[model samples]
Target: MLNGERLTGTGRSKLTAALALAFLGAVTSVSGTSAQSAVPKPGASVFTTDIAPILQAKCEACHRAGSSAPMSLRTYEETRPWARSIKARVSRREMPPWHIDKTVGIQHFKNDISLSDQQIEKIVSWIDAGAPRGDPNDMPPAREWGNGEQWNIGEPDLVVMSPKRVVPAHGPDWWGDLEVDPQLTEDRWIQAIETKPVGVARRVVHHAGTTLIQPDGARESLSEFAVGKYGDIYPEGAGRLLRAGSKISFGVHFHSVGEELPVVIEVGYKLYPRGYVPKHKVTEVNVGVINGHLFDDLDIPANSVTRHEAFAKLEKAARIISYQPHMHIRGKAMTMDAIYPNGQAQTLSSVDRFDFNWHVAYVYDDDYAPLLPAGTILHTVGIHDNTAANRLNPDPNQWVGFGNRTFDDMLQCHVLLYYMDDAEYQQQVAERQAKKKSQTTQNQ
Candidate 1:
């Protein structure tokens, strides 16, 4: 999690001008697609048979009424006004809100909602052909969208919710730690888990991570959710253990979007039967340095790109399941490289173009999980562009530092890994302890 308390950066209004340029540029680029005179104009009949179906299948899930999207696109009337915007968005491959660059990294995600290039072309072609009112009959049957009442996956065995917290209409971003008790009398194994935002919070909430607090004041992560993130389901043989008398706490980061928003986030847990035991223990760890001195000194001179590096040495052999690169608006690129003690290096995952709006956790397919051995060093590199050329730059002249605010920046390579068994986990713990003692003895 990015701690805002350590923020060190100058604020400026120059970022506003950059955002304006970005918006105008996007509109101009999309309009250019519509100006292609050589492209034959396909009429309403083409739209009826082709475009309507695509929207129903691909865009309606989020763009429908009562959803997170600002407008409904369920019908022709609802979608007609935003024709140019739709064309622009699809033309840029910015809609559907999926951020994974399919060409790089692992591509097989279960919750991927990205529009194919072919689909994007279809939308653009329809717009160029004068986005017609397609035949009502040709439109596919309206989908029965969920209203947050039912879980996407069946009902959970246990559901815990945070108390209502009001987000101010205009204020600095806020982070809240909500503590709740699950009141379990015995241990349990979590097969899957999900967190849902109630009311307007869905739109304003940025990120949330769940932690389990023990009676002895120790804490461990239970789950984490980013924007557009679906719940997590561990592999059949792996599950997270929850001991009795544990408390669940949610660390929620909220962004203000001009209107007061009320939020009460609810977490649902699907558990295995009481007698079931998992073959492997699933856990998550922050691999790279975050909000530390090295990361905080992120000073990008005007018109210059800054690169920063951090490393995390592994004490155990583990299999990595997923990767999520964390940075602010200025972040241009990020990559995670695994460097072995033998001096061999391999790139685990890389995001060439980081989008502040669409944060995705790239989960590798079962066959492609990276198996990192003990003594491997995870190196993370972050590239930040603070020049005027960056559309999202708030202020290119201002020096940015590690902070929780959106303007302030951070570099975090969040990785999820798990040991093969309890024995392996204990062995890793002991090895780390012994290494720490050895270092202390040498220093003394």
Candidate 2:
């Protein structure tokens, strides 16, 4: 259940959407009667309808013969023993790590693999109830995966590929900043964005991105204000600013993938038409913590448990349509709670575990996901554990802070939002519709 009352800011609902996105796309599911029959009973043939489809739709892409995941769940023989682990992740809403608001209107995420609640129940029940292998005939056909490993959706409108940066096969995992010249964009609003794949010696890449900033030959940027450890959440609390006439360059950070595979990185972004300009320029919000003097730096190690909070007061009220939750390895989870003056705290987003590498923008539904009221106070809380037990932990003993470097940790909830101009926002929607209609008519 929701922990508190509805929030009210000046921009009201507009602020809600923006703040909510600060969280990774994890959601709270409300259940009644347990509906406990979702999982299949044990002692049956786990065929197509029973299990193959689920694995294909959710696991095959990454777990295939030579891929990133640890093991492949391609065949029933391979999946049977590990059914327990699979069911666990699904029950926790972890697999198919998607981060979009499903309660909202008809919206699709650029990168989504989340299973429905019912589906999760089925997997769980099947295991608890004795994973019934229904029948071989019931099993659906297996799918063929491709080497391209592109988005499930084929062919984006535009593809901006970044030049490759080679990392020596052996080392302490080198980190460097590369400047990308976008050929030149005459002011184009990006509609969709992605990171293109480059061959690597190993999956050693930590994180890479296109930070829209001043083209003043800056290799990297610090947060808006670094407030020690606890307040590191708002290092760039106000959001990173992208000035006019600036080039969006790649921020490349990688560790040797595996053995000696050199690292190469590429970026892909699709832009809106030249005429369409969002009222608000690009802004990426980070709502994590900074270490404080009150705590011992050594005690607050990388994977050691820690806490922090931050706030961003909006000057103009605008509704946010989408956002992204991000954190380095040490970060366990995060929440962006909008606290009203009346003490109401509404959950904008809460991601329990964040994957720094696979970050993407998320657009919420129309109704459930909207803006917060103006005058709303966006408070974000971040949790981190800089410890040796952390699988992705780089350095458990080192004191951590917010930065683009690997050793340093971060707590950020970045978002892409637009000003709430009823006329202009709607006009852009209409223009998009008209363009679609005209193109359809011409094709027909």
Name the candidate that leads on lDDT.
Answer: 1
Query: Alpha carbon lDDT of residue 8, candidate 1?
Result: 15
Residue 395, model 1: Cα distance from true site in angstroms: 2.8
Q: How much lDDT does candidate 1 score?
A: 0.71
| lDDT of the candidates, in the order given | 0.71, 0.52
**Per-residue error (Å), model 1, residue 418:** 1.7
Tens digits of per-residue lDDT for model 2 on 274-327? 566544553444443322321222125544688766666554444555556666
lDDT of 2 at 327: 67
TM-scores of the candidates are 0.76, 0.64
Each model's Cα RMSD: 10.8, 13.3
